[model samples]
Target: MTGRSQTEDLARLFAPYESLAATLLGRWDGSIAEGDGSHDRSHLMRVWQLVRRIARGEPAADMEVLVVATLFHDCVAVEKNSPQRAMASRLSADVARRLLDGIGWQPARIEAVAHAIEAHSFSAGIAPRSTEAAILRDADRLDALGALGIARVFYIAGRLGTQLYDPDDPMAERRPLDDRRFALDHFETKLFLLSAGLVTPTGQEIGRQRTALMRAFVEDFGEEIAMPEDLALAD
Candidate 1:
């Protein structure tokens, strides 16, 4: 099959699975907190879209595993700093396995899906052993870096009553970077570094673009907040 035809075929095969996963997650209709807007069904679908795009560049990636993993990656949604956060991926993976079994997915495919889901979380500290797992991990992380990522940082902070920044040191230059205390600190501590660790070439390219956009925003923000004397002194 020509490359275009193969991609079209793959998309057709995964479309139903994506719909089923979305339907299942929609029923949950839950969030981590009352005001939490990130990590919802919308987030899942966005990551799934990324998975499809990234998978296109990775011929070795298992589309089935990637689709199932992406859908369930955040199905269990724990707070970022919760003690249970590290295990959230595993819990989601277990739930995914059960769901896949109910749909008559073969044990091997189910296992592949579970493993991909389990290894997709940044907090899980598990290296992806398969291309599908790597794609899922990269896709999910991609969603946490660009314009949407900036909004999510502030959204979660607002939900937790955290400050937008430390006026004296927005970049946390002298103090430790505490994203929990200041939303802007997240750019320094995590967002800027994601591009380096992205597993797939396609993901890395997208990560670079998003990271650049975020960096520009931070620079502009710092300039906007600088005291007139500070700008004059630099001049």
Candidate 2:
């Protein structure tokens, strides 16, 4: 198939899945998915929006791969602490492949999507290859910024029973998550690192600005913790 034809074919394949994206995210449905709310379907949608927005501005972007990769990046949940974390990541890719195949997507398209999904996980440690992969990865990180990012942090924290912040216990461990460790540690580890790790130029710029926003929020949080009564000082 010609390049444009291939792109159009992929778009056709993805149209049905695009419609079902909202239905798959049961947690973000009513009142934040009835869970701690970490990354829900709405989170997936936001990443999709960011990916498309960034992709549209790039002349060389392969929008199909970005769409597929973003959709399946978190098809399965990562365990906070499990020897099976890798297994979970792999399962997500497998699920993506199956769905893509079921939709009559080309084998090559499915492979590209699966590869991107496999590497999108923070713990996966796999480098992205195509432009689509890079954009999707950066888009996912963008979800960790702004007010939505803040809500997700606390939501996941509440799920794990972790406090919002505690300067006494520094973040040292390198695992998924558990109830004990404070959620703020996430900022120190993944969130802070994400901005610098973006692969695309658009992603890098947006990540930098968003990271600054998140950092400022963290700093304000620290200030509030130091003196909750003097709220006006933060302003």
Candidate 3:
């Protein structure tokens, strides 16, 4: 989707929290528009969808917190391969705290939002401490699975100029898995393992479904690339 369309969708999705959403969209729209395809507006919209879906089962979650957290979760864009990638969520939470505090949100609520934003990142290695945080984490990670996740893996690889896979050893039977150098290796490196780490039951169920799809894709991908004798297709 075009950035403008995605922004419009975000405006609608967060319509209940219009004032805060407007403030964020106005300030971050340019950055989001210029960001890599994997972390752009469409990705936010998808995460919002998952947040709502997961929240239904997690009735204790604070929607306002989810709303603001989703809006600023990736406010600070860092490339996946950057040394600073692990700090991206922390940096975004800091920005969210400043913005929400400026808007007069209560300290506790702002902290809730910030925590959700901070704990949502896979690279951050922080355990979620609240229902909102767990839901947001699961929601965001859900976007990194399934068909959408597959597309993002390659989209980011193209941005980094990485090969589709290491042609000599596509499955990395000898070489270590290096997603920075080969896109397909990312499945085993992270994507394939995401479902098992999901926090919410709802998110876990959906994650399992999506992960199955991704698994099938990788199996097919393997068959197409590997030599006949080397192939050991699953029964």
Candidate 4:
């Protein structure tokens, strides 16, 4: 899609919170010089959609905090394979703190938003300490579990020059699983495990549904590729 069209679409998505969207979008453009398909504005919008859905089940969550946190959760773009990947959430949280401070937000509220942004990351390993943080964390991760998750896996693998799977052992029946070398391995290494770790009940429920789809995709892939009968049986 054209850049203008994407911007217009995002504008419509965030129209309910114009002021916060304006500030967040401006900061986002300034932060990421080169955006990837997987973590661009579209990703933010999807996560926001999920956050809103999850928040409906969580009455105690602060909508404003979730909005701002969702917008800035990945303000700093870090490659998935980067050594600094784990610090991406912390860096994004710092940017969120500065932007909220500039807008004269209360320290406590800013901290709340910052905490949600900081803990939303999978690699960060920071537990969500509040309702908002937990909701944001669950929402962000939910985006990485389903159809979008499937698309993103291959997209990133192509970018990283990884294989679709091992030609001789697509399901890794005889070889060790390595996501860095094969895209399909990631389903086992991370995606399938996400649903069980989800913090919110809503997120967990959605994750289970999505992950089941992912598992079905993997099974179909194995069958289509005609995995050896013995190996398939072992799997």
Candidate 5:
């Protein structure tokens, strides 16, 4: 058998982990509660779904590990639009270990999952280890694209209440954005950076399409702002 099939067979052994993972994810009351737009369960589920689809093409990827890692990746995200990248990475590793233990995953497998979760943070600056890790990383980044990303930006901005860009307002005086700065700045801050970091072929393709869509959206948004009379995508 090819290595891909072998990995698939191995994953079958972990078929019983879904419930355990869902239970653990339900406990993630971090940023979502306070309305931080960074990462939430809805976001987590979307990434989890994307990772699963990627694994279908690259069966060598471990579904169980990626599922668990993605679900728990941002369990400790910044508190409502803060830059808590380091803390999120650290907390995800700890939480992944605990959840994996409760599910009785092998010690080695648990450690691998923990390592992948901790290192998957973009700011953590660690390269991916397993295909599972790469998939998880790509999937996480994918969540920051297209319409979902737009909603996230405004949702976060509203919570933080940051203002839009201002040629006159001092840059240093701006608070971390809540809603206003999000529309103007998302293109540069996060959305524009995702396509390059995507790892899987399937993910990269989707990222490309989403990037095009987002760029168009941003350009049009700019026009709408310049005139405030031509709201094309308002519907």
Candidate 6:
């Protein structure tokens, strides 16, 4: 097959995945409360972009499995610290399986997609066993870093009535880091450590850069809010 024809064929094969994503997103629109913007349709789409990029770097990655998994990875969004947080991915996997079965996806393909979704969440604590699952996990975590990650942190914190930082101990020098109370605590608790957990080399490189950006912002923020005593202590 010619290069152009191969490209066309690939596009034709991928079109339905994109269509299903859009259809599901339309149904999800406005169903979530305004404050839950962090896990909205846009987030899923961004993760899809990363999944494509990461999949390109993995010769054995199953694109169809990755695409379907990315679309429904967060089909059922829950609060960060909710009691059901760990079950979110499993619920989403079930939803994706039912939806894929309805659309006549092969049993093997549906199982692949379901496993990828089930293993994608940080809270779920399930290790990814497939290339597609690993890519999905890395893609989702990548969104929780960099400038966009900064915006999401504050957005969710504001919605939950959390402070920007702990006034007395912004870096939590004397206390345990609690992201539920201060947005900045999230950097120390989670965001800064994501790169180490990434499975793909492409994702790890991107994650390293984004993590640095988050670290720089945290340093700048600390400087901006430093008290005389804090500055003196640093000296």
Could you say which candidate leads in lDDT?
3
Candidate lDDT values, in order: 0.78, 0.66, 0.86, 0.85, 0.66, 0.79
Write candidate 5's Cα lDDT for 1-235 as tens digits: 1244433442333345655544554444333212343564456557767877777878787766776777667766555445665667777788778767876789998988887787777777778878888888777777778777767666666666665544332222355532335455656666788798888898899899888888887777665555233543462
TM-scores, one per candidate? 0.83, 0.73, 0.90, 0.89, 0.74, 0.84
| Segments in model 2 whose C-alpha atoms lie over 4 Å from true places | 1-36, 167-180, 227-235
lDDT of 3 by residue, 71-190 (tens): 888878888779999999999999888878777889999999999999999999999999999999999999999999999888888899999999878999999999889999999999
| Model 1 alpha-carbon drift over 4 Å, by segment | 1-35, 230-235
Error (Å) of candidate 2 at residue 176 is: 16
TM-score of 1: 0.83
Which pairs of residues clash in candidate 2, taking residues 3 or more apart in a chain or in different chains? Answer: 27-33
Q: What would you estimate as the lDDT of candidate 2?
A: 0.66
Tens-digit lDDT track for model 4 on 1-235? 2354454565567657766766655544454323688888678778889998998899989888988888778878888999999999999899888888888999999999999999888899999999999999998888888899999999999898999998877888899999999999999999998888898889989998999999999999888888577986998
Candidate 2 lDDT over 139-223, as tens digits, reads: 8778877677777788767766787765443333345443347787778766778877887778888888888888898778776
Query: Between which residue pairs do clashes occur in model 5?
Result: 157-178, 157-179, 158-178, 158-179, 160-178, 161-178, 162-178
lDDT score, residue 13, model 5? 31
- Residue 60 displacement (Å), model 2: 3.2
- CA-only RMSD, every prediction: 7.1, 8.6, 4.0, 3.5, 8.9, 6.8
lDDT at residue 164 of model 6 (Cα atoms): 90
Clashing pairs in 1: none
The TM-score of candidate 6 is 0.84
In model 3, the Cα lDDT at residue 85 comes to: 96
